[model samples]
Target: MKVADFHYERPDSLAKALVLLSRDDADVQALAGGQSLMPMMNFRLAQPDTLVDLNALEELRGIREAANHIEIGAMTRYAMLEASDLVRKHIPLFSIALPHIAHSAIRNRGTIGGSAALADPAAEMPALLIALNATITAVSTSGERKIAAKDFFLGLYETALDEGELIKSISVPKALIENRFGFYELTRRHGDYAMAGVAIAAQHMAPLTGLRIVFFGVSDRPLDVTAIAETLEGQSATDTDIVEAACRAIGNQSLHGDLNADAATKTHLAQVVLRRALRGMNA
Candidate 1:
């Protein structure tokens, strides 16, 4: 089906866009790259009455470096990120996840903010954000607020973003010298959504302290599995018995099934991904 008829407003300034979004009489939505939104709209998944085009907003279009973190504008495209030296140097794990997002055309048209805002349970960005302990900046007519990535995703295709507020940027802390990361996902094909995936981060080698295990395409949102991390704290990579016990905990969690895979299959795949990711970690 074609998208429902909607009013389009191409606001040159963010202030104007915010004003358009703040209107209470009709459903208002912000349009960035429109990669996801357009498809969703076309399928009747989204039926906004008015669309505030933010493509012209210069404030939402660049990657900047801070002393402690990298700030990426909401409108930054995946292709740009794939080519960014800063991203490759600082967030090497992101480099691993980027190539799996979709095809080159989708990557060229999809914005990081759009992916985060859409909050698809299977999307790589949300899970990576949580693994990196990133922050999202949200702006609106009322004011601006920062949300931790862990606290931002509320449920499947849902987020903590309030009405009329738009994602402004994302902030990710720079990886330290001792930091180590491992990312793995199982897809039917190269660019298909994963049946299950894992993103792992560790502080150092011998101790394996500050371990973060984030899983996607397995639950309502990215499952951090903090319990497993707590259990693995200070454990070396060779602790197979303890790792197996921790992985068994994954089987106990509630999982949602998709068309091609059942909950049990996804649970098994998730376990495999966790183990694979852990094995790939240096310590």
Candidate 2:
């Protein structure tokens, strides 16, 4: 199906884009890579009266190392992240997971910001960001605000982004030597959306250290099992310990399922993925 008629605006600057988005006179949607939005529009799942194209906004398109964090522009494509030394050095988890995002064609056009902003429960970026404790920067005519990854995702296709706010960039702390990371996802095909997934980032420091275990595709939003992390804190993190923690962490929560799998099946898959991720810390 073809998309319905809509007015299109290509903003050369972020300020211009923000202004275009803030106009309450029409239903405006921001367009990044157009990987997700285009399909939605084509199927009439999303019928925006206007589309504020962000491709021309150069400010939102690069990777840089800040004082203690790496700032990735919202428009940075998956292919860029997959090949970036800066990303591999600063956020190794991106390196491990980007290849699993989708096929080459999709990765070539999909933007990190688009994935996070869309807040698809089955996407990898949201869960990875939550595990890494990253921050999402959003901008608008009012001002700029930084939302923690944990607080950024509100629910399915929902986020803390106020109407007219555009995600500018995402910031992640530089990877540390003591940090161990793991990522796993279950999909019928290499490019298919994951049925269930898990991302784990653990700091094995001497004191005040713990891990963040985030699950996606099994809940309304990325589920952070901090309690599970706490349970494994200061333990040997052996296979048995990881399995036990996995069960204890997800055993009580109510996980939702779809035609792909039942709730019980998703929960079991979550446990399997979580265990593999935790074990990957030692790999």
Candidate 3:
């Protein structure tokens, strides 16, 4: 099916895009890479009256190093991130997850900002960002705001973005020498959406200091096991300790189930992935 008729406007500046999106007379949506939005529009799942094309906004198209963080412009494509030496060096988890995001064709057009904004429960970017304790920057007519990744995603397809706000960039802290990152996902096919996935960032100081275990594809939003993280933090993580933490972290929570897998099956997969991710930290 083809998308319904809509007014298209290519905004050369982010300010112009925000102004266009602020109009309340019509349903306004920003177009970044058009990977997810285009498919939704074509399937009639989304019917925006106006599309504010942001492709021409040069301000939202680069990856750079900030003071102590790596800033990725909202329009940066997955293929660019996959090949970026800066990303590979500073944000190794992104490098690990990028190859698993669909295929090369989709990666050519899929933007990190789009994936984060969509807040798809099955997407790898959101979970990875959460694991990294990243921050999402959004701009609007009123002002700009930096939202922690933990608070950025409200639910599936829902975020902290207000009506007129657009994602400007994402900021991830630079990995320290002691920081260890791990990512794993289970999918039927190489490019298919994950059935269950986990991303971990831990600091192996004398004792594991910062331990973040984020799970995706089994919840409405990325699930951060804070209690379990606290349990492992400031302690020597042994094989038995990691296994027990994985079970305690996921055993009580309710996970989502789909035609592909039941809730019980997804929970089991979550445990498997979490165990692998934790063990990878020691490797």
Candidate 4:
């Protein structure tokens, strides 16, 4: 089906893009990789009056390691992150999760910021950000602001971005620099959205100091089980303890029953995956 006609604008600078998006009548849609948006547009799911292409904006592309955090430009593609040795060394979660995102062809063009802004519950980037406690920076004509990943994602396919506001970059804090990270997802086939997904980052202190567990494809947004982390405190994360925490996290979750598995089966799978992730971390 052919989508309704729309005008596309490739602004060379952030200031120009902001001005175009700021207009109330513009009905602007920000274009990044166009991996997700293009399909939706083709299916008529989106009917924007104007497209603000950020491809030419030099401000939106690169990876930088700061004193206390890793800064990734909004338009940096998944392929770039996957290929960057720096990202693999510093933020291994990105490397671990990137391979599971769609396919290589999609990854070649899919931007990290675009994926995060799209806010797909099953996407790897969002889950990783949650597990890593990263912060997102957004900009608009008015000003720029920073938002914690926890606060940024409001619900399914939703973010805290307001009208005219575009994601500028993401800041992943380096507090747990040597933390063990694990990302695993169960999908019907390669590149398909996961039926059940898990992202975990835990510091292996003698007492088990910090643990972050996030699950997607089981809720409107990536579910963070901070309470479970608290429950596992001072306890060595044995298989039994991991199983208990996984069970608690998935006990009453709202996972959809799809062709891959039923809700009951998914709950069981969640426990298994969680245990696997914890064991991977422990190893």
Q: Per-residue CA lDDT of candidate 4, range 68-179, in tens?
A: 7889999999899998877877888887788889999999999989999999887778888988889999999999999999888888899999999999999987645557
Error of 1 at 193 (Å): 1.1
Looking at model 4, the pairs that clash are: none
List of clashing residue pairs for candidate 3 = none
By lDDT: ranked, best first: 2, 3, 1, 4
Model 1 gets an lDDT of 0.86
Best by TM-score: 3
If ranked by TM-score, best first, what sequence of candidates would result? 3, 2, 1, 4
lDDT of every predicted structure (CA atoms): 0.86, 0.89, 0.88, 0.84
> Among all windows of ten consecutive residues in candidate 1, which has the lowest summed lDDT?
237-246
Per-residue alpha-carbon lDDT of candidate 2 for residues 46-106, written as tens digits (9 for 90 to 100): 9999999998888999999998899999999999998899998989999999999989999
Cα TM-score of candidate 4:
0.94
Q: Tens digits of per-residue lDDT for model 1 on 14-97?
A: 888888998989999999888889999999999999988998998898888999899999999999899999999888888988
Model 3 lDDT tens row, 22-105:
998889999988888999999999999999998898899889998789999999999999889999999888888899999999
